[model samples]
Target: MQPAVTERDLNQADVADAARYLAGRIVPTPMLGCPELDELAGTRLLLKAENLQHSGSYKMRGATVAVGRLAAAGQATGVVCQSTGNHAAAVAQAARRHGLAAVVVLPPDAAPAKVARAAAAGACVLRADGDPHEVVRQVHADTGYPVIDAYDHPDVVAGQGTAALELIEAAEAAGTPLDALVVPVGGGGGAAGAVLAATGRGIDVYGVEPYGCDSLARSLAAGHRVPVTPAATLADGLRPACVGALPFRVLRDSGIDAVGVGDDAIAHAFRLIVTHLKLVVEPSGAAALAGALRVAETSTHRTVGVLLTGGNVEADLVGRLMEGSAA
Candidate 1:
């Protein structure tokens, strides 16, 4: 068998190549600026509007690349993956675009909108109460289909990095290069991708998590991979029990920092984004801005870039959050 791939095997070039391959296939989401948010944070904030991306999240970037590769090989009858929400929808949509079937395993508590979106995209959606990874493995074993891990796969990581690469390039084109990049962490694919995209660019990368759901922070602090039973938080997408092994290696080697944000802060950021930016960012996406505000408290990052990861929140939750009554 071939030697197992590690984080070291992936690099910035892979991200650049992914970006090139995805040039016309995906949306080149806008880099938005909000004076109100900048004033509140006491620093300029460059928001990557990935919430408007295809499949309604940045997850589309990685899913497209992964699915396209399988389609190109002309062997996969279908693709399989497990996710809280966004990745499932993205994979389903990508598979549809490539004319391949998709099987997505989601947690029992996955958001209804996300589940509906995945199903609408023609994916066979399955809900499992146990570990999603194990369920994905079983699905692949039963169907003899290739599995595209949400975060661990090299192609996924490289594809996800394209979002950050686009943000970095957009900032430079506007003559305001990013000093810091903040992304809300789930399984850590996007954060690891940010690390790769911003490498050698003098950019400080940070991974954000909901308070008490901070597996990445704990893992970083412990100098090893650590798992946590995620706490109750509105940012459901960030509730992964632990960072992916590949992402942990990339983050640990890059010395990237992690931040923890509470629900209240995330809600506040959500309201602010909706009010000023006129963008309906989900709590998971808003958490990046919350973490950026915290980072700005002590850091000298004048211009920070935040990835608005997704916008697939439930209607009831959105209403509750907008009414300022969400717990």
Candidate 2:
């Protein structure tokens, strides 16, 4: 038998260290229950509301942790990062708090709301014509402070893990040991962390990806990181082409599977979440719940955890989408 692939397993100590690294900075996003979601899925569904996070997503956790770590090490000049949306806002917000300058490289097609928010948070925003990921790399190479990656860095991965750490703890306290933890996979930090945390707690983990851009799913099937080709999806935050190197290592070693959901399902989830839950979650953020709704046939449990990652969609876009299909 092949030696069990146990390389990316993270221990309690590692989780504890990550928690401490983000203790007083990032918001402790709440794990919430939805009877409607439960009724829809025929299983109890708990939503971890990272949309309420300070920067409107769990990206802030990783951005804050990585920047804070650099600051503690006396390398805090300023920070540079790239994003289609949430990660730029995250880096801007965290950089502001850390007393560091922030320069964000954003795609020309990034959400207007997020672009303005990043500007409001005091980041020098640059519009890039090429790929957002490549722009991130170029900016990092040119700037010296530290690059706050969207999902690939070890520090970012560690920090993103805290969301699951907090979620599981809260779930246990409420007497609901999660049967599965589902998370959106853009560059894969959140899903990677969810797998590490959920498996550690003996809960199954699932990584949800957009059919418009299913990097994690493609990567997993190919047994290597794969870059996603351009496609049109409203999940702006899920537009990254490839899973992050560090996060991919964790996902592969942990044996977590990826689930692909169509844009229609994600749109439906957006409508359902906002109409029923009164929470305006971004399409990428809602991808995990979309997966749960579609992946129940593969599961063996009655309860699941879904990371509601952000609520940063543009109002006009939401209006257009809602008018089209109520999704």
Highest lDDT: give the candidate number: 1
Query: Where in model 2 is the C-alpha error above 4 Å?
Result: 1-12
The lDDT values for all models are: 0.91, 0.80
- Model 2: per-residue Cα lDDT at residue 7: 55
Write the residue-wise lDDT of candidate 1 on 214-304 in tens digits: 9899898899999999999999899999899888888888978899899999999999999999999889999999999999998999899
Q: Which stretches of candidate 1 lie over 4 Å from their true place?
A: 1-8
Which residue pairs overlap in candidate 2's backbone? 228-241
- Error in Å for residue 292 of model 1: 0.7
lDDT of 2 by residue, 1-327 (tens): 111112554444554577776776777777888888788888888889999998898888878777777777676689888888888898898888878999999988888989988999999999999766576677677777577777766667777877887888888899988878888888888777777666657788888877858888888888999887847876778878788887887787787878888888888888888887888888888787899898776666778888888989888768866776533
Native-referenced Cα lDDT, model 1:
0.91
lDDT of 2 at 28: 78
